[model samples]
Target chain A: MDFFHVLVVLLESTIRVSVPLIFAALAGLFTERAGIFDIGLEGKMLGAAFAAGAVAAVTQSVWMGLLAAILISIALSLVHGYASITQRGNQIVSGVAINFIVAGSTVILGEAWFRQGGRTPALGEGARFQTITFPYADSIREIPILGPIYSDLLSGHFILTYVAFAMVPISWWILYRTRFGLRLRAVGENPGAVDTAGISVIWMRYRAVICCGILCGFAGAYLSLAMTAGFVKGMTAGKGYIALAALIFAKWRPFNIMLACLLFGFLDALAIRLQGNPLPLIGQVPVQLMQALPYILTVILLAGFIGKAIPPKAGGVPYVKER
Target chain B: MSTPYAKLPGWAEYGLIPLVNLAVAFLVAGLVVLLVGENPLEAAYHLINGAFGRGEYLGFTLYYATTFIFTGLAVAVAFHAGLFNIGGEGQAYVGGIGVALACLWLDQTMPWFVVFPLAILGSAFFGAAWAFLPGWLQAKRGSHIVITTIMFNFIASSLMVYLLTRVLKPLGSMSPQTRTFAEGGQLPKLDWLLAIFGLDIGTAPFNVSFLLALVAAFCVWLLIWRTKLGYEMRTMGHSPSAARYAGMSESRITVITMMISGALAGMMALNPIMGEQGRMQLDFVQGAGFVGIAVALMGRSHPAGIIPAAVLFGMLYQGGAEISFEMPSISRDMIVIIQGLVILFAGALENMFRPAIARLFAMQSRRSAVVAQTKGA
Candidate 1:
């Protein structure tokens, strides 16, 4: 109704929309840090979303749904690691193949199991996530900036939304502070050195991939069970790629991933807000341009129009132990 | 990556392995269909009947094959140059813009013959223009070609959506498509060519574009295997340092190679715009460009391999539709699974069985050597 209320709504929408992206970006950070390029992030997320949504709809338990999603996504990760790490296959080709397989299989399996044309039955309230409320939030809403922040911005998001935001710091710690993080970074940079130091390069990469799978699983589960009610076809639609773009935009740093995903989320929220909203100078904006903005921005960033964005040096190259 | 020259005969290397992969994919597809409570054998029959055994359907199958051939060769050309151009989907989508503009401009004044060639060039030019930046970025900016190409695809799709809805839609028409092309914009069907040979068949969308696909294949073969530039591309793809030592400009070659690949992908619009739709429309390219990846990989990035592979996919597409038609339980997504399985086996798992085959070859040679030694003794 008022300008401040609108801003609060927009911020709320931004956080809500960015939950999956934050999870996915963190997921990509793990694999890419270990020198594995995971274009199949999209595929894994899609599979998990479908699995989570279907299981939750049937069993009416969000926890079991989340578990199923994690298992399925982990299975896909194993497939990718086996192909790229064990078989020494082309990583890009393997990723593309995984996308193809997951994209197709999710639909087929959904159709066979549910007979609902690639969608699960929408879940009940018990099967979907509930919002968390901060203490004494409603009583203080009459005040100005802090009131709206308390009432609209910080309060009443699905439980996973907080987890998604919290993951940024946790990821930062895991990637930059822990010994495993140090070893993972070194393994990606020089697997030979890690190998010489008595660490197994194959095992290290597998571990990174497993972490990636878990994060992506959370992202997918959130999309189906928390953000929305059921798994529609391709519900994770390009967010996986968007998270990937965010990954590169942040140069694979965890904190940077948060900033990038939030930025994308804000842009998405703005697009939704600006659907037919008019401005003083610009007049009513076209929906297409707003919809196209994120991609255009990514291209600009990637083309070195903004700044240099380099991936891990050894990313996409399969590590072969020449014995 | 190139495999060491196989000890197995050429047929076994090319034919046996791919066929085995196809068989495995089909077996998985059959199982999926059975899981949905359908008969796989009957489903296969229906697919065959829909693609070929049914009336005039072979023409449609070849029609779909024509588009695959173009996009497949686009991928193959880039592959041979050590570039992964996944943006073929985007390139082809943008190619529709070129064809649309050409038809809109020339239909009012020019003859069909003159307009057709001009439109063909227009499509290639536009598609190449779309791809030029990614190629340039890959060459000069040290960006990964696959990432840049993929990023370009999203941009292309969005750009096309904007162009269609905001710019190209006819006045008072809510639909995001241009008006039907005039006579000068249409390309004659292959039925006319077949009529010249006195072969009567029912009407289908099969067009002269199939012939163009064949000609393009021949030209691609010449360019890759016979030309100086072709030699440079292969050398570069195999080993970039070796190419640099041989005095080739790496950046120029990368740019040129991607442009050529983009042009080939762009040409696929001829069938949909000039042959099937006879007008500009949103989503003219569909998923054909993505499918081209599977085609190129399964074909081993060879023109010789790509043509047959394209035809086989064309069958799967047309037949998959038939399966979805007669049996409601086996939905359209089943076809996508089959396509994915084929990609999994043929591309990702390509080397999975090669070692075993090579072992067999080695064992046979060793047994013969043992027998010869005994005979000499």
Candidate 2:
């Protein structure tokens, strides 16, 4: 293949792989903006993936699987909300607990329900998200650069991929332009001020957490029904953490989040492509190094080697009403 | 309306509350067992029996507990300094490299006794070094330790995989592990210690590491409760602003505390590498570092409580393995579920029952005060 074709393929795969990261990073943006540190994003995504895969396999309805994924993820989010918000507990500990619970429960429940060794049956075509080919893709292929870019790179993506891309602008509008978004951001930065304005800080945080749940649910469904045929054991495979790194790397901005996710996704695609492939001077690049790049970059960014990425002022502290 | 805050007595605060939380965790776990279509009571019986039924079972339980103690103390020490050290898993993993290097170098030349101390030092140094960057980042660079530590975990996993597969793997070896260590590298089994109780620890990997764990626990207690640095750590943990106001260096304490925690976590590798596996291998830590979080929270970050909590988890692990053997439907993941529940109840939902219990205590104290007034009248 020519260099251009390889580049197109690489970018296409980057978009495909980044779909989950986009969903998850947006999910994190909502919660972190509302001052709730949701380390449980991994667990929520995993739970949703299992639920979607199992329900889709059993009912053979993609809609039902999506519904199940959303519900289960929301339920887990509420558990986090209860511990961190209502009980005024340590948010990190609550998130960690949720992660562990979901990680263990998904396997146990999957095994018990499916009898397939912690995996659901392979999903049918109807039960999985079908890719949508953009109009005029076949006829436009005769053109040189733009034709392949339109047909191969942009077209023939699963619906969730489009939805993930669409969410960026919607999230940007919701976080920056809307009234609720303003309140949510205000609550995260200063719950005391939001509370003084008679807007309920607790309710604002709950809403943000639920929004996080919805986005994570979509991320999970994308993993099981859109990315692959079915859910394997531990299929999320630290993508949630990568999403978190991307979120931090982006400094929790919607457009920046998308850019970060795409960057990380490109690294992932490159990692897979570069396995055992020799470069000009470097000889063989270790796939592990490629895999570790996003995290390494995130750490470097977090260490302020690049520009500073400050979290919300009240990011981890639980608000207590002082009489 | 919220109930008025009441100061709890030491016994209720430390002992009764934790027990209640533990009971709730176990009850939830039982519900999970029932959901899996098994007899919860029967599972409980089997679990207890598997942990303590025979000398061999007890030996295995203690063997697991030894690893937990090291990790638990690691978390607890960090907790004392108000830092959450979730990188125990990575630290422990890197610590294996230290133990392996020591053994690979001295195993064939030196006696076991001479090599043991060097291995301990090597593991501690590597573990501490692994943690140092995150600590420095948190202290000097103003980064969150939690995120950095978590990032370090993935980096450690990748580094270990590279080392084991490409660098450390012996020539012509199919497996991604080093060759078994020589006799000097192996820890002597503590069979005689168990035999003194008129019981044989048959084929258990229980070894001198158990005693090392105990000694470490004692040392941790001395460090935390009996030293000037311990007071500084406690002050910082209680209130960082107060610690700073008192002229304690925040950066120094944070870095030193993390190194101490990392050293303890690193020592955990000895239990498996020297005591049991006798060689470095992949994933030998096996979530033990995470288990330390549960142990520290359950034990209230005290060495006195950590030992018992670690042993309880050891029971759950040993028992869970037994249950999986006896029952086909239930897997070892059941223990993980229980562990999650324990962390949830004991760590996060710890205050769930505190208010009601405090109210009960308040009422009792009020009643006694009224009776005393009537008697004085």
Taking the candidates one at a time, how many backbone clashes does each contain? 0, 0
TM-score of chain B of 1: 0.95
Which regions of candidate 1 deviate over 4 angstroms? B1-8, B192-203, B374-377
In the order shown, the candidates' DockQ scores are: 0.63, 0.82
In the predicted model 2, the residue pairs found to clash are: none
* Per-residue lDDT of model 2, residues A1-323, tens digit only: 38999999999999999999999999999999999998889999999999999999999999999999999999999999999998888888888888888888888888888889999999988999999999999999769999999999999999999999999999999999999999999999999999999999999999999999999999999999989888888899999999999999999899999999999999999999888888779899898899889999999999999999999999988888996
Tens-digit lDDT string for candidate 1 (A164-214): 989999999998999999999887888888999999999999999999999
Task: Give the 10-residue window scoring lowest on summed lDDT in candidate 2 chain A.
Answer: A98-107
lDDT (10s digit) by residue, model 1, range B42-139: 99998999888744677778888999999999999999999999899999999888888889998877877888888889999988887888899888
DockQ of 2: 0.82
Model 2 residue A291 CA deviation (Å) reads 1.3
Off by over 4 Å in 2: B1-4
lDDT of each: 0.86, 0.93
For model 2, residues B1-377, the per-residue Cα lDDT tens digits are: 24335779999999999999999999998998889898999999989999999899999999999999999999999999999999999999999999999999999989889889999999999999999999999999999998998899899999998899998889999788888999999999999998999878998899998999999999999999999999999999999999999999999999999999999999999999999999889999999999999999999999999999999999999989999888777789988888999999999899999999999998999999999999999
